[model samples]
Each structure stands twice: as structure tokens, then as C-alpha cells.
Target: VGRIKTAPACSHVPELPEVETCRRALAPRLAGRTLTDAVTPWPRAAATPLVVTGRCIVRLDRRGKFLLLRLDRGWLVIHLRMTGRLVVVRELPPRTTAAFQLDGDEWFCLVDVRKFGRAWQVARASEVVGHLGPEPLSRHFTAARFSAMLAPRRARLKPLLLNQRFLAGLGNIYVDESLHAARIHPLRTANTLSTGEVRRLHRYIRTILRAAITEGGTTIQNFAGPDGKPGRFRSRLQVFRRSGEACGGCGTIIERSVVAQRGTHFCPHCQRL
Candidate 1:
């Protein structure tokens, strides 16, 4: 893998991989711990925050980009929007919108500069994430199902993939990267893809997401692991923000356009529209 000192400023909200990284780090530290207290400097950070106080955490789970803290009584669902960071530390970090007093002298904090992050206490996690479509990495999301699902959509591929109600856990970064890898143009209409193209797209979506999770996610902007490390996967990105650079596959300069109101990067030679 290549090495980069910092990620570019082009990436958007935390996707499945970034949220998953946070979940993996928090699960071990907080699974059995009781929520001693819940405090939010920003009042909008959590809804019914105190409801979770004194509840024992069952486990840390993630659906799409939301972190589900399964409590003995209810679920504490958190969505780390555009600029949310979940960290466990001895002292509260700067920009701490909300902090939970965890056992073992650690603090589970949501440090968000944008303040777009939100947490909720609910009887069912589906209250927040129930409408989301199938997880791309789940075994049940087979190519046949994906193909069938696409057959009815008339939307563009990039926008359709980014829609959580269609397929969960994808954001601008992964969708662009996956589409480029699958040799599918972002502006292509969903129902126009052939069976082989659908299969390839499905495979690359799963593969890229898994690899990104392994590298701690693509830190295009303010993302960082619970350990305070920027994602290594940025070094492996093919065409998300490499506009004006040579295409690795065909040596043609990569291009950029607006699709679904988001900046899209792709190789004109590799991903002909």
C-alpha cells in the first residue's frame, strides 16, 4: 500500500467502513460496561440521552453508518454524520458534542466539529435504520438479488448506490471507487446495465468495502480510527479524487463531473459512459 501524510478534502460523510472501524474499537471496551451518565454539551447531540444512563451495554453493533449500542433495556443509536468522531479517551477531547461516562475510567465521546452527529435511545434499532436496504457485504445480498433490484430503478447508478434505502453502507467515496473498478459509468441509468455488468458491480462493491474496512476506511477529510489513525485505504484509492491524474489502467487522464450533486471521478477510457 502507498503512504500519504494526509487525505484530501474531497470525501464526504463516514460510510460503512468508517463506522465499522469505530464499532470494532468500541465493542471491546464497552460491551459489558454500564452507562454511568450521559452528557451532551450540544443539546441536539442526542435525543433522550439520559434514558440510557445506568443501563448496561449489551454490545456495539452497526447498521449502515449508524452505531447501535445495544443496551439491556433499549438501543442507543448514533449516526456520525458528516463530521462525527467516536473516541474513547481519559480526558474529553476538544469539540466533544456528547460524552458518555463509561466504566473502567474511560469516556466514550462524540467529538464532532460540524455537530451533525446524532444519538437516540429507542426500543428497536429499526426505528432509525429499519428503512435501509440490504447490506452490500451481507451474504443475502447476492448478485441475482442485486440485479433484480436494479431492474426496476430508473435512477443513475451513482445516486442509486448512494441511496441507503436501496443499498446500505455506501457513500460518495466507496460508490465512486466501486463504480470505477467495475468499469461502470456513474451517469449510466440503473436499468441499462447487463447481467455481467451487474455481477461485476456487485462484486466490486463488496470487495472494495471489505478492503476499506480492513484499512480502517478512507480518510478523505476528518475521519480517523478510535486509535487516532487516519485511514490507510486512502493510499489504495483508484479514482475517487485523482482527477487530472493518469488513469492506472489506460494511462488516460481521469476526469470529474457532477453526478447526483456530488463530485465524481473516473477514467473516461476505463468507464466510458
Candidate 2:
């Protein structure tokens, strides 16, 4: 199932809520001011220790829902799995779930997407290494890398998309949407893409992930943005959990099944293998 064995035993990855929670968590302190230190109360899961604590925060951005803490020494790349959340509590959440501290005044909580995916405590900014895949938008993660990633694996594309080591920050929501948008069968094997399809798939993957980040990701369950608000993207979904619902484009009923071991949705008519 492409599991990395982080902490918990859940069966999910960087779903929509975890990303949105991170955006809300650091917006207040990270927007205008600077981050002086990085604290990992949970050594096994939090990002790297502090680097640019007192300096001005250049910006806080999301790379596939992975919170990129752009600091002076490096980027504090935070990956929230099934239950990851970057909550900015005045002190602490007063609950047992109070996981770790990121900045001085801010606190980060790894909610655990099955507690599988882990936070890479990296020291280099924009320099991801070993076992990490290409950023969908980066110049390095070109059509070549995308093609190469699938060329060798026989795994299902849905699970492949969820693999951060292959492509970081992409989760179930974006994968489902990308498959639907590209009209490519999600269950197709890795080596099935043509040159044209690879380019289109590349564009759609970036496009879909970018759009979701703009929409703040989908909210199905207990996920709330960093400010603790519900996300609205779920209402705008085409085929995510809307089984038996008419396809937004072709009006065909959306179908649901297990793909790559995750609950997946698609329109049989609009998207064919």
C-alpha cells in the first residue's frame, strides 16, 4: 500500500484537512513576522529544528499540502498524514493530542492519517533528496520524471499519486480529481502512458493540485482549516464521495470503488481506461 510506517496505524495520507489545518495554523505568526526556531515536541514526526527564527518570513506556501516553512537555513517541510494538523493555540490545546511545537507561539499537531506519513526534518531549502519524488510544479519534476516514476512501477496510479516519495503533497482528493480531469483510468498500470498523455497528465496533476490548494482542499470529516473552519471544496467535487450522483460534465452517474487500496470515485463514461 506504499506505507512508510510513521507512528499510528491509520490508512490515509495527506488528505485535504491536514493541509488546510497547516495553512490556518501559521497564517497569523508566519504571515508578516519571522520564525526564529523550529521545535519538535515529537521528535519522530515534526519538521527540522529552528533555523531562521527571528528573520522575516519570506512566505508560507504549500507544496502539495505539505507546509513549506521557508526559513533562512532551510525549509521546514511538514507532511501531515491522516491526522496531521498545525494548530496555533495560545498555549497548548489542553488536550492529550497536543503533539509538538513549531515556532515559539505556534504549536503543531500531527493528527495522523493513519499516522503513516512522516515529517521530513530537512536542513536544506528547496533541495529535497532521497526517496522524495518531484514537486508537481517544479522544473525538475518534468514530464520525464513523471513518466519515469510510472515507467517502472506496476502499482495503481491512485496509490502512486498518494506516494509522496514519488510526488509530494498530493493526496486522495487531488488524485481522484486529476484522474477524472485527465480522463485517464485510475487503475491503469504505470507503463501505459504515451508521450501526449504524459504531458496532459502532468498538466492536469499540477492544475488540479494548484486548484485544490486555492480552494483549501476538501473537507469530509473532522478536518477544519488552521483557523478551525470547514472547507468548501467538497461541495464542488466532481467524483470524490458522490457515488450514484450524476457526473458534473457528462451527467453519467459517478461510480465508486477501491483503487490503490483507497476509496476512489470516477465516471465510467467521462473517464475510460
Candidate 3:
């Protein structure tokens, strides 16, 4: 629920592919415009204030899945929670539950029914720089770096991947899919993966993420690209919430279990420890 509380602030879990997806969705809208105005109706509520009013949106980029709005003065970083989606096509009506909105992205709406998403209007880049880790697809997020992150922690691998500080932009769906892809148990100790397994893990992370993005980001709930079509990727998902169904690869009945309290799915025979 804590993660969900950050939902309105969540932006597609900022995965390598989702970040790229958001970049595509937001870039065209912001390319030649300036965030000429900023306001927050509820100042004390969880919100991102207008931080760089006079600055033009220099570049729209992503560090992991978090959308970074580079301005001449500072930055605006957004993390869309479970229901969080960065849209570009319409001026949506004010959701009774919307947390906030940024005018720059044609319509930046933080619409989480549970009010879990957040926005940061920042005058200083340092505000969020300390919060995110290396991009999984960046040249620096190597096997060596992935391996090193796990060496010191005794935590279960699943939750560790969900931790932004550990390595930003992974979430329940990708964690489940990646673990199953690597054929590793979700409960495996972070430090125990072999070099080969780590290599497979890296490959699977990108593959699953990129595949999901190509299909328009999974919409098991509220995710949708600028087109408003539901994400088709959920139909292609291998094991996330596919319990009681045949595994796509081996036809074994997929199963569900608890790992770090997040209900998880995997093919028992294909994803054994």
C-alpha cells in the first residue's frame, strides 16, 4: 500500500522501456513550448509545485521510468503511480480525485483514485537525483553493477528490484516476468545469482520491458498510451497474473504464490529454483 500511496506519483514504474515510451509521448508536446505558468490549488497536499515557470522545457528525458522535464532553471520530475499515466492528447475534465496537473504536457494529469501519485516541481536537480539509481538500459547499468547491487543485501530479490534506490524503474509486473524469464525463484537471495543467471536476467529485463512498451504499456488497470487504447501487452504477458492458465512456453499450469507479500505468478515447472 505504501507503494500504491506513491501511485499518483508513479510513472509506469520508470522502466527502461516505459521511460522511452514516456519520452516519445511527452517530447512532441513539450518540444517547442514553455511551462509559462504553474499553480497548486492545494498547497499542503502531496504535490509538485511549479518550479521553473519562466524556463523553456529544454528537453524531455527519462532516468529509468521517471519523466524528467529539463528547464533552463531546474527540472520537473514525475512518477505516475499505479493509475498514473502521462497523457498528451486531450484536456481531461478535473477528476474529483486528481492529485494535480502540469500544464506543459498538453495535459499532465495525476489521476489516481487512491491519491497515491506525486509530482515534484523542482528548482534544484538534487531534489530527485539522490532518489533514482542507474537506468537498466544505460551503458552503466552493467552486469557488474547489477551484481554489485545485490552483493550486500540479504533482502529477497523481488522487493529489491522494486526499490528505486536499488535500481530505479522496476515494479511488480516486470519483477514477476523477469524472474520467471530467468527461471529463478523470486525468493532467491540477491547475492546468490550466478553470472550466467545474471546475464539471462539482464537480457530478459530489456526484452520484457521493450516488448511491453511496443504493445503500448500494459493496462491491467489504468495504463494507456496517448491513443487511449488499452495496452495489448497484458494479453501477451507470460506469467504475471496468469495463474491457473497454461504457461505460454511449456503449457504447464501457471501458479501463484506470495513473495515479499506481493501476490506473484510463475510457471512452476519452468521457473524452478
Compared with the true structure, all predictions reach lDDT values of 0.85, 0.62, 0.67
Best by lDDT: 1
Model 1 Cα shift for residue 147 (angstroms): 0.6
In angstroms, the error of model 2 at 94 is 3.8
Per-candidate clash tally: 0, 16, 17
Q: lDDT by residue for model 1 over 161-243, one digit each (tens)?
A: 99999999999899999999999999999999999999999999999999999987888775443336777799999998899
**Candidate 1: lDDT of 107?**
75
Better model by TM-score: candidate 1 vs candidate 3: 1
- Ranked candidates (lDDT, high to low): 1, 3, 2
Candidate with best TM-score: 1
Better of 1 and 2 by TM-score: 1
**Where is model 2 more than 4 Å wrong at Cα?**
1-28, 31-65, 68-77, 96-129, 224-227
lDDT of each residue in 65-137, candidate 3, tens digit only = 6677787767777665555555533444343133223353444455444444456767766587567877776
Q: Which scores higher on TM-score, 2 or 3?
A: 3
lDDT of prediction 1: 0.85
Quick one: RMSD of model 2?
A: 7.5
Q: Note the residue pairs that clash in candidate 1.
A: none
TM-scores for every candidate against the unseen true structure: 0.93, 0.71, 0.83
Which of the two candidates, 2 or 3, achieves a greater lDDT against the reference? 3
